[model samples]
Target: MADGIDQLPVVRTITCSHPSHAGYEKDFSEFWTGAPDSKLTNRGDTKKWNGGFRGRPALADALWPELRNYLIGRKPSIFNNAITALRAFWRFLDGYERYGMEPISQLSDISTSLSILWLNPIDEMWSAHSRQAHEIIGVLVRNARKREKMQSAWAWHPYPRAESTESKELPTEGQIRTAMHLLKQSAYGIYARWKRADAMAAEGKNLLTVSRSRQGERNQKGQLKRAFDFELTEADAHATYRAFIASSGNPLPSMADLFVALGLNGKDYPPWWPTYSQDHPQAGQVVR
Candidate 1:
């Protein structure tokens, strides 16, 4: 008869969680999207908003808690570094999904059987966090019954720990030449803009306005036919009256007639100026 044998029973040794690993919260999936704005502040455990660890709420829930618990009370530095490293691993998993392979539902799903996948392509390390990625997975999934007995899960370690390449990487001649050409062009553009601004500032023209005074701006008398912007405040009105009294006579009847002979270009002014000037022409008329 063909086998009537049932699958063998399994027993686990490590608890994968310890009493000492008790400081941080289990669910940090909220840190993925609406980060600091999501009512949770970064207090030694969670990080602030970042593009890392985004768009996978379910995977984040499954993995982040165990990772956080792995080094919660022990080493804050490694925990922070692992945040970045783990995100790279998550992106790797995304690639794993795109290939139409069986998706990993949990941390333990990454068995040692898949070790060859990490080694075959030399450039695969570009998407991973190097050796630290192994350490991150090992620490997160290894939950011993007791704190002292805890060890990294062997399933993840042997893979990303591949040896370094034989030779050093260097830029090619073409790459160097193109880089130099681009830098030179950028410098020339910056110098041209700086010289233009310097020339504009030299002429009594407002450097920000970037316009020079033209021949059309000058009247027949050769005077600059520009509008004089004078705003009268309480202090200014008082100062004008004081200047008039001290000199024995103000040249203008009121502040109103000051701009009357020199007409406004349909601009707004205090209504009282025109009112005072219109009401009494000879009231305060004086010598030039």
Candidate 2:
């Protein structure tokens, strides 16, 4: 039974055959007729008396709270009745419709649901848990239809991924060689020279070889002074390079030449060259 209830068909009617207000009026008449105070009159029985008793307000106070509870809780029954009333009211205003009446609940959600359910051929009420539930369902239906139309317009075809133009325009082998040659002449090469000099200096030697004499010169006091000769071993060169690297804040060397300005090594120096070839294939090789 619970499964059946879960699978129950939706009722999407705008209204029933009769208006609830009309039903209330009919019942009210019957109640009035049964009243003990009910009295009849002749054509001129009293000057103030009319043919019928004065009509009471259509709805009672108790009915209002029941209606309020239904709308607040979105109890399915209130949702349906409110929608029904709205549809009837609209139809009544249209004048062309024979059956139309105002609805009980003035809630916005209830009115929205009525607009949708009123579209159904069966013209039945749709129950919802909350006033907004009606609006939510309408939105879902509208979005679903929009998605369907979008799918059909392209014949349900899938779009292919776009290829990157940059990849297709890759540089040729000649361009690569030209880039390498230009890089060799860049500041990176200068840094490499400084790194080699620094490494050598760490080992208590200089990477640059001074061909000047080791002979001493006489001092002011007639004492002989040792020559200012400079040369660096491989380990010293490596240490010198480390120091140069530290002065750089570990940043990649800029394109401009900072090496020559620091006097690491130069074209004037040969054989005692600043760099260790092969180990440093690039202009500058960073040691880990």
| Per-model RMSD to reference | 29.6, 35.3
Give each model a TM-score.
0.33, 0.19
Estimate, for each residue in 1-288, the C-alpha lDDT of model 2 and write its tens digit: 001111223222222223443222112221111112224456645443111221111222222333333345343454555644433332322221212434432222122223322322122222223334333333332343343342111011111234668555778999987875664354234434544543444454322233434346655644324333543344544443334433443223332223343342322322333344355554333322
Deviating ranges (above 4 Å) for candidate 2: 1-165, 169-230, 250-261, 264-271, 274-288
The per-residue C-alpha lDDT of model 1 at residue 265 equals: 26
State each candidate's clash count.
5, 23
What tens digits encode model 1's per-residue C-alpha lDDT throughout 103-171?
754544453323324322222322434666655654554432123342212232244334678688877
Query: What overall lDDT, based on C-alpha atoms, would model 2 receive against the true structure?
Result: 0.33
State, as a TM-score between 0 and 1, how close model 2 is to the true structure. 0.19
lDDT, candidates in the order shown: 0.39, 0.33
